[model samples]
Target: MAISNKVYAMPPVVDANSRLLFLGSMPGTASLAASRYYGHARNHFWPILYRLHGAGVPDASYEDRLRFALAHGCALWDTIASCERKGSLDADIREAVPTDIPGLLRAYPGIEVIVCNGGKSYETLDRHHGMHPEVLRRAVLKVPSSSPIPTRQHKGLEEKAAAWLAALSPFVKPRGDAQGG
Candidate 1:
């Protein structure tokens, strides 16, 4: 049987200095249950971040993870404000209502790049906001999802991490930036 339920996304993890916004499609089952993004222990999202910047992960509390991300000028959010889905799988999503992308960009004026965590997120944003190519052209980037579930589409974790790091590097300030320029 298909489990149908409304899923809500967490508030954007943002700050005045946010320079990059990472958007996922929607919170999965684990994330929704924990009321935290990427709460699943097997998920590579947090680990990837740690690998990129050598920040605390695999041990730090959820709050600390958020602090580290924000301190590095990275913002996290999901594209769909709400959606009906059976499980964590993005394919099961239906009747997706997108978050206010324009409002977010306006509110976080420091955001210079937009990174979609997976194809679902990129597709959702494109479907809803593709009409304005000019806005998207500014930086809407697509990156592999950090979910543990693997697929033929993505090679492997290492490849995915490399792509993510490359895409995010331009927008993410160097680690030394945290020490102040």
Candidate 2:
């Protein structure tokens, strides 16, 4: 791969109150270009989050969407810190450097769940830090990818949202409620 193919992940969106850590494999081309997580118009990440929180629609601006997630104790990040890949697909990824998840877990002890956003993110996390004590203690879930690409099991936005909700409901709280309901 050319040097130009090397893509780096954005800094994690986290805070002291964050209790749900959502991790993707890495940012796709659209996300990288926009300098935001899940920037693709068709991507289901934002929509699913909004639906989970009972927010009728996602906020038009990226910053507002981010704030909403933070308000609900959701933290967004990627498993891969940097990697070389020709395109957005996880299969194209090569020379992957994983992010310091354990360090982040240590820093934010309030985080109780680790939700891997897709197969690649979970695979990388398991391969790299599966045995770590911090990871072992948390509720780690491998959910379907929020990518626009459809699979046999998850073909539509609603399907994806349902799957994500099933995995996240136990940890997620209502929009303004700090305590889990």
Candidate 3:
């Protein structure tokens, strides 16, 4: 498919050496506009990831947020890099163009795990491109989304955002392996 002017940007790169990868469905309106991940203010992706990885709370800047994710050996990306949606709702998407996820695997030879942010991303990824068997074998976590739209019960966090991050612990270790949650 031709790259549409409406096409949103995917992560600049999927770190090959990552042991953990957080996959969301698609970028929201805010994210597309900002050309970054988790740009929505109400979204809890940043805070949750920071708290979960013991990276301390993130600063009020996009640069810091990206640094935090990259530092933890965790890759951040979305299942559908480009999707036609009137709004941020996943259900509203029409013409979806998923990114070259397989290419990322080939490019980053060290990835070993995938953490789906929600059922939508899970279904998309699980149904479309097949992830590395080795990565899926060790960790294929299905966690909640920070998206307020998916209102449901998650682990202990109550809020989907916090719960999602907390759930990622098994796949993503803390900054130091000396402590385990």
**Model 1: residues >4 Å from true position, as ranges?**
1-4, 56-59, 153-155, 177-181
- Output the number of the lDDT-best candidate: 2
Clashing pairs in 1: none
State residue 143's C-alpha deviation in candidate 1, in Å.
Answer: 0.6
Model 1, 85-147: lDDT tens digits are 888899999999999888888777888888899999999988887566434645888999988
User: Per-candidate TM vs. native?
Assistant: 0.88, 0.95, 0.81
In candidate 3, position 179 carries an lDDT of 68
C-alpha lDDT values of all predictions: 0.82, 0.93, 0.71
Q: Give a tens-digit lDDT track for model 3, residues 30-127.
A: 88888878888777777788877766767788887777677777788888877777767877777777766666766665667777877788878876
Would you give me the overall lDDT of model 3?
0.71
The candidate that wins on TM-score is 2
Q: Using TM-score as the measure, what is the rank order of every candidate, best first?
A: 2, 1, 3
RMSD, candidate 3, Å = 3.7
